[model samples]
Target: MKKRLAIALMIGAGLLIKAQVGINMSAPQAILHVDGQKNTAPAVPASYYDDVVVTSLGNMGVGTKSPKTRLDMRSDDRQNAIGIGGTAQTASAAKAGALRYNSGTQDLSYSNGTVWTALAHKAPNDFVDAENPSKQSFTSGTQTIVTNWTKKTDVNGSFNAATGIFVASKTGVYIVSFTFSLASGTIANDSRYETLIQTNSASSATNKVFKCVGSYPGTNGLSNRVAGNCSGIFNLTQGDNITVNLNQALGTSKTLDADATLTSLSIFGL
Candidate 1:
């Protein structure tokens, strides 16, 4: 009876041990092999019972609820890594990769690698008057010279005006010139004339005057037409005006033409 009890106890203990024993796998897949003996089971397809994370390492087996690691046995390798958070990280990456920013979409797109795109809020090169009869107004001292219609005036170009002075709408360097011709049947000795380019206002503070004299051939023909040119450089502030002044005090009032031609009206950085 004692021997039988002892045997029963041993059997119970063995059974408990068997139930608690666990099988260890060399890899994620179970491939059993016996040492110094022929294989009993044929090779079966290997399937991982767990998810495998591969890195630069050797293979490791995990339990049912655990993970596995597979090795990437590369001879040559170089890498460094870090994790960044938030939208700023994504934005920085996109920009560094040369992505396009879409304001409407609020997203970035990879560049197609060709053709330049227009930047935001860029100014155009030239100013254009889209509408007709672009009325440009400029003020002259005492008298105002208003032009009906004319092309872009060049430096030293002549302008015909009803008034004695040619009002300058555009301020720049100019070589002022004048042409005076007497009406038909007028004699040379009849009258004298003066053509001048002067500042519009009369203040001793900042006024400059330039003048020249010539005889106008009577209107019998284009001959005796008095023409003269004066050249000078002027630094004119924007909105400051200039005009041509003709004095016929010396001669009979004859039809006179005068112009303020811009020699070079260039702008530079102040």
Candidate 2:
């Protein structure tokens, strides 16, 4: 080891005169160059594969001979990742621009020096709207779970239009909302109606995310069309499901309805 070190020093001294040293190659392309593969015939390496270099400006390049940043790395057609361990320590303004894995939030956090911001990706969002719309019938004197929804715009494929259930893909805070327009001439002046938004977490009969109720406005002359809209913010777990329901009173039967203007459902992460 001593002999090898002495020889290396002597060789380094010879190269020091030119202020450039190279390993595994006769010509040095940078201040410090180490070619792991020693396949130096191609002139320009492909993204510096099997190569490391420190430029004269003190920029280090991994897998590339030309590094634009302080520490540049490239691996052509290969996966590259940095594994960071979670820490309990808090980040402060002094630590601005620092990065760490936050176990509590299970997210990558960046420090602005005073506070840590979770670098979460874009949240999921979905929307469904009714055009012209259709009517669904239900027996009076009973609460029914509304289903058989066909109009849908589920970008994430997280909603089942036929089943009228939206399943959450991740655990996060979400904003949920739905609007339903009851068919005109179907509701009576003496009748009452209800609309509900239920979730998988609330299994009990009385539990629900939102409930809308209304009574017929007045006798005869006025428009009998009724519409109900409900919205709620919830913290939901992954795979949780949400569905809607309806009920009407004082009529032979009640029909769930919607018009082009007042029917839609939307769910989005915050």
TM-score leader? 2
Error of 1 at 245 (Å): 1.9
Candidate 2 local distance difference test against the native: 0.70
Per-residue C-alpha lDDT of model 2 across residues 1-270, encoded as one tens digit per residue: 999999999999988766879899888789999888787544555635777899988899877788888987764534346678766566773388888875434578888878878896654454444322446777776777666666646666877766678877666777877777766664456677777777785233344457778776566434466677778887776667787777767476645565544667777765
- Candidate 2 has its poorest 10 consecutive residues by lDDT at 123-132
Q: What is the TM-score of each candidate against the true structure?
A: 0.29, 0.51
Residue pairs in clash, model 2: 48-63, 92-113, 93-113, 93-114, 96-113
- On lDDT, the candidate that comes out on top is 2
| Tens digit of per-residue lDDT, candidate 1, span 1-270 | 999999999999987644421133333222221111221122431222222222223342321121243522121121212222223234344454344544322233442344323334422111111111313222211232223323343232323322323333333443443332322333344344455556553223366766665554433342344333443444443233345444553333333232323211211111
lDDT of 1: 0.34
In model 1, the runs with Cα more than 4 Å from the true position are 1-149, 152-185, 188-191, 201-206, 215-226, 256-270
